[model samples]
Structures are given as C-alpha cells and as structure tokens.
Target: MLLALYAALGVVALPRLLSQVAWFERAPRLAIAMWQAACASVVVSALLAALAVAVPASVLGHGLADFFEACATLLSHGVPFTSASARIALLLAGVLVVRITYCAACVLLSARRERRRHAEMLAIVGRHDSRLGAMVVDYDECMAYCLPGRHGLPVITTGALRTLTSAQTAAVLAHEHAHLRGRHHLVLAAVRTLVRAFSGAPLFARASSEIARLVELLADDVAARGHPRVHIAAALVGLATGRVPDFALGAGGETALVRVRRLLDPVEPLRQRERLVGILTIGVLLAGPAAVAAMPGVRAFLAHYCESFIF
Candidate 1:
C-alpha cells in the first residue's frame, strides 16, 4: 500500500512538479534522464506494491527457507494464492506488465514499418550527396531530418540547400546526425509507449510531449558543439516552415521558434553541484521504490540470517 501510494504520487505529482522547473531547458540531457527515471520508478513501484500485497510479510520474516518452501508449495499446488486479495493483486501486476510490454512492442513495430516505407520512398526520389552527407530530395520544401535505425541517415531537400548557407546547412545536418547517433528515436519511443499504455494519464502524456521537445534541444546542443550556434539558429529559422513525417526526427518543427531563440542565446549548462544534485535525484527516483519494497526482506535478513550466522 505504501509503495502504491508512492507510485500514485509519482504519476500524479511528479510531472506537474517537473514541468514547473526551469532547469530542464538548461540541462536537457539530465532532464531527459530524470523523466525516464521517474516513469520507470512509478512502474516499478506499482509492480512491487502488487507483489507486496500478494506475499505475506510474515513469510519473509520467517527466513529464506520458509520463503522458498511457500513458493514451491504454491507452485506444486497450482493455486498461486489462497487469499482472494493476493490473487487479485498478482493479476493486477501481470496486467500492468503485459500492457506496457504490448504498448512498447506496438510503438516500435509501427515506427519500424513507417521508417522502412519512408526509406523506400527516399530511395525512389532522393539522391545521395557526398558533400552534404545526406540524401537530397528534389522537393521544393525546405527541410532536414533523420531516418533513425540501424541503417539510419540524414535527409535534406534541395529547397533547403538553395536557402541555407554552407555553414547553416552543415549545422542542420549535424543536428540530424546527432539524432541518429544518439538514437533519440528510442527515447521518444519509450515515452510514446507510456502515453499509449496510459492514454489519459497526465504524467505519461506530458512526459511524451516534453521529452519530444527536449530531444530537439539536445540535438541542437550537440550540433552547436561542432558548428557555430548562430549557424544552428539560422538553420532552424530557415527550416522552420518545413515539416517532417511523424516517424522522422527533424531539425525544425513546431518548436523551431523556441529552439532558434535558445540556440541564439544559450544558457549555461548545469553547474557541477547542480549536475550532481540532478544525478542524485535520478538515483533516488530509480532506487527509492525498490528500497521501500525490500524493507521486509532486509528486516528478515537481519532477524533470520544474522541470527543463524551468529549461532
């Protein structure tokens, strides 16, 4: 029940709290990690909560021998739990796990299919440009994006080539390259799965949107490392009117205006102490639930294992 409460708070409270924090823009990578950890922590807590309900605390207190014996007996009997509540709790845990797995699989498979189709289309309409290190489509729309996968590559349109300067074009390509190299699609997929699995949940929905925004920021930051920030900002502004397919990671989209501004006037990265604090926060988010769930076992280890060793 305690673990369940924590999970509930994580789902309902964490997102709202994190959304209000301004540090995310300055430290997007850390922010992404924090969001992922929070989501993982909530799921784990829910699973642990159900397991806690299904297993009697007294069984743990007795010792490992008793714990194994009880589990074996249940397996042999083919009736997992004598108590209705325990059976229900176990079933709930199973449902949560299955739902999340199903959603994740669906999101990945769909993205893969889309990417393959888009790749086929690109092969038909686009030509490789050695100078640009990207496939250039003859389309008049100014755009740049990456098709992410094992064979992922950056893509650009001739319209954009005519519109951007050499430096701006390089910056845009760098941004797309960052997306492919970082496998930012996988991060987006994880959050998308959560949103699919729990559609109306504010945490999952907001995280999906926020993480989507953050990834572009992260890509821009990576691009800036190799190219001038002004070039990145100029590229973003030039590509602002263009759009990419839903499955592709683009350099510019609806968030382009904000991203351009951010690129032009960058904030300082998180300080050492602040970065350390963020890392610690992520650790707590990931470990706190497991620690709570293991309290009974920890107590049992001290009471039973320690006593036997001493004797």
Candidate 2:
C-alpha cells in the first residue's frame, strides 16, 4: 500500500518538482537521466506493490528452498489464489505489464513504418553529398535533420545550403550527427511508449515532452564540442522556419529560439559536488523501489541461510 502511494505521489509530484529546478538547463544530459529514472521508479513501485500482495512475506522469509517449492507447486498444480485480494493484485500486475508491452510494440512499429516511408521518399527526392556527408534535398526550405537507424544519415535542404555559411552548415550537420551517433531516437521512443501507455497521466506526458526538448539541448552541447557555438546558433536561426518530418530528429524546432540563445550565452554547469549529488539522486530514484521490495525476501534468506553461522 505504501509502495502504491509512493508511485501515485511520484506521478503527481515529480514532474512539477523537476521542472522547477534551474540546474536542468545547465546539464541537460543529467536532467534527462533524472527524468527517465523518475519514470522507471514509479513503474517499478507500482508493479512491486501488486506483487507484494500476491506473494506472502512468510514465504519469502523461509528462503530460496521454500520459495522454489512454492513456485514449483504453482506451476505443477496451477493453485488458485487463496484470497480475493491476491487474485486482484496478480491481475492488476499482469494488466500493467501487458499494457506497457503492447504500447512499446505499437510505438516502435509505428516509428519504424514512418521511418521506412520517409527513407523511401528521401531516396527518391534527395541526393547524397560526399563532401558534406549528408543527403541534399532540392527543396527551398532551410532545414537539417537526421534519419537514425542502421543506415542512419544526416540530411539538409538546398535552401539551408544557400542560407548558411560553410562553418554554420558544418555546425548544423554536427548537431544532426550527434543525434544519430548518440542513438537519441531510442531514448525518445522509450519515453513515447510511456506516454502512449499511460495516455493522460501527467507524469509520463510531461516527461516525454521535456525529454524531447532536453535532447535538443544535449545535441547542441555535443555539436559545440566540434564547432563554434556561434556558428551553431547562427545555423539554428537560419533553419528556424524549416520543418522536418515527425519521424526525423531535426536540428530546428519550436525550441530553436531557446536553444540558439543557450548556445550563444552559455551558463555555468553544475559543480563537481553538485553533479555528484545529482548522480546519487538518480541512483536512489532507480534503485530505491527495488531495494524496498526485496527487503523482506533478503531478510528471510539471510535468516535461513546464516542461522548457524558465527558473526
């Protein structure tokens, strides 16, 4: 029951709390990890809460021998739940698992189909540029993005080519390359799955949108490592009006103005101690639920196995 309450509180509170923190803008990568961890924590706590009701604490205390015997009996005889609460708890856990799995499959399949269609379109209308290492489309809209996958590649429009100077173009391409190289699409896909699975859940919805924005900031940081920040900012400004397909990760989007400004006027990043604290927080968010769920089983195992041992 406590675990369920924790999950509920996290769903309602984490988004609001995390969003209010200013340090996230200075360290987008760390912020992304924190958001992901928070989501994972809620899911794990909810699942474990249901399982706790279905499985008796006494069975866990008896250690692995008894636990395995119970499992074997369950498998061999298909023993029915002894209580209505146990039956309902197991049903709840199973439904949550199946829903998430189904949603994940849907998100991945839809993204794959969209990418395939977009790839085919690109092959027809775009030509590869060896010097720039990107697919050049002859459209009159300043745009740049990457198609991420096995044959992932950066893409640019002729309009952007004419608009941006050589150095600025390099910066923009670098940003797209960072997205491809980092496999950031998979990260987006995972968050999208959560949002789809939970539909109107505020935590998943907010996390998905915020992570998408943070991803852009992260890519800009990567691009800045290889190119001048000013060049990247200038390229973003030039490509601000352009749009890319939903399947593609683009260099410019609604966040372009904010990203451009961030690039031009950099803020001080988290200090070493602050970063360490953030890392610890992420660890706790990820592991806290599992530790809570395992405490009874662990204590049981220790008692059964170490009863005869001397300290």
Candidate 3:
C-alpha cells in the first residue's frame, strides 16, 4: 500500500514536473475549473504519497521515523528562494539566463536585420501584391509576420504577385495581415523563448512544435474570418513551398499537413486543454516538496529509506 501510494504520488507529480517545460509552449485553451481540479489532484496525490512513506511498520521505526520527519520538514519548508542553492532560485536563474541570452542575440544579430528587411519589404510593396498584408519575413526558417507602424503593413512579394491569382493573393494577404493585426508574434515569440529556456528537456521541444502550429492555426482562424475556404487553402498552398528560401516571404512552419486540412475543413476552434494541462503540471511540480512537509507517513518512509542506507 505504501509503495502503491508513492507511485501514485509520482504519477500525479509528473505533469507538474513537465509543466515548467510545457506551459511556455503552446498553452491549451480549457476551462478554469478543470485546470484547478487537476492541480488539486496532483497536490493531494503527492501529499498522500508522503504520508505513506512516513508511516512506520515495525519496532525499529522510531529513529528512522525521526530522521524522515526532519528531512520532510526541511523539504517542506519551501525553497529559500533568495539563495542560489535553493531549487526555486536555481530554476528562476536558469530561465533568466535563457531570456537574457535570447534578448541579447535578437538585439545584436536579428533585430537590426529585421528592421532593415521590414523597411525594404515595405518599399517594394507596389512591385508586389498590394492588399490585406503584413510583412512576415521567413528569416532563418522561422515564419513571422510584422505589422508596420500605425497603418497596415501590406506585405507583397514579386513572386506571389506573379504566381498567384488576385483572389489567392488576397487570401494570403488576409492571412498575413491577420497575423500582424492580431499581435500573433508576441505569443509565438514567448513560446519560442520558453522553448529555448527548457531546451534540455524533451517536453520543451514538443511544446515548441505545438506552439508553432497553434500560432499558424490562430492566423488561419483570422484569415478564415468571412473568407472562402478554398481561397485560404489555395493561399496556404501558394506561399508555403519547399523550394522557397528562408529569407523570402513564406508560410511553412509546423504541421503543414494538419493545418491545410483544418483550413480547408474549418474546425470549431483550438481549445484551452493544453493550457490547462500546463498550469496544473506546474502546480504539481511546485507542490511536490510542500507535500513532504504536510504528510506524516511520507516523512516516516524517507527516514527509513535513509537509515537503511546508513545501516
């Protein structure tokens, strides 16, 4: 029963452990109540696990129980966030390091180039497609759309103008413009930044991929606003091509196969389930140490484990 409890506790905490890596990815859209319920479940499970561990089974249990109680208390005391040795502090510092590095790299390497590219793209608008546009550059294989200052940034490529029919161009323009108007870049950038922070974790990579898809789906949602499905589908097919260079205007990021179908068929919407999972996961992880402090049986279990090692 105690072993079973410990296992359950570990299972409950799994989502939380991954959430620090997941939430910053493509956060799902789900109900608040469900989110909180899952969080509570994780906490309760972890605490129960600790309780099981702390329960003594035999006559030699007293000293081991004492040791476990002490360890549990220390673990539950909450990490000394101000100290570098503290787990919470270390985690925070690691995230900050990633953020600063990302910011620095953007400022030094990508920002200026982006600015120059935006200006150039804007100037060449007349030579390309003219309506419903934003200059979302495909720099470094990452697709990003930018809204020009104040007025709508009508992004036009000479190729899109020549290759696509007027309606197709309009569809593409609407999609990109939706991205600019909607401030989609903020969400996308935030997810990527998080992905970089948790790069060591496998979940982070998966989150990054999901986030990229969600952003595109979000844009497609916008473009689909009062537009024909065929138009949107054609425009997507038009811009996203394998042969296109990363520096040019393109629309190929994540999950192209799925996205094309969604655009054509028009699903209800992207739900918040992913986001809910993410929040709950983080909650469990943050609560893990706290449970040890609160649960007596878990304290006993750990004490025995420690003493067994000693003996």
State the lDDT at 57 in candidate 3.
33
Model 3, poorest ten-residue lDDT window?
25-34
Model 1 whole-model lDDT (C-alpha atoms): 0.89
Give the Å shift of residue 177 in candidate 3: 1.5
TM-score for each prediction? 0.91, 0.92, 0.49
Residues 1-311, model 2: lDDT tens digits: 88899999999999998889788989999999999999999999999999888988768778668878996898699999789999999999999999999999999999999998999999999999999999999988777889988888999999899888999999999999999998999999999999999987889999998999999999999999999999999888777644343456554455877887799998788899989989999999989998888787788777766875755
Candidate 1: the clashing residue pairs are none
Q: Per-residue CA lDDT of candidate 1, range 1-311, in tens?
A: 89999888889999998898788999999999989998999999999999989987768778668889988988898965869999999999999999999999999999999999999999999998988889999987787889999889999999899888999999999999999999999999999999999997888888988899999899999999999999999887776645344456655355877887788888888889889999999999999998998898778767776788999
Give, for candidate 2, the lowest lDDT window spanning 10 residues: 243-252
Candidate 3: residue 85 lDDT (0-100): 35
Predicted structure 1, TM vs. truth: 0.91
Q: So what's the TM-score on candidate 2?
A: 0.92
What stretches of model 1 exceed 4 Å from their correct place? 58-73, 241-254, 309-311
Query: All candidates: CA RMSD in angstroms?
Result: 3.4, 3.4, 11.5
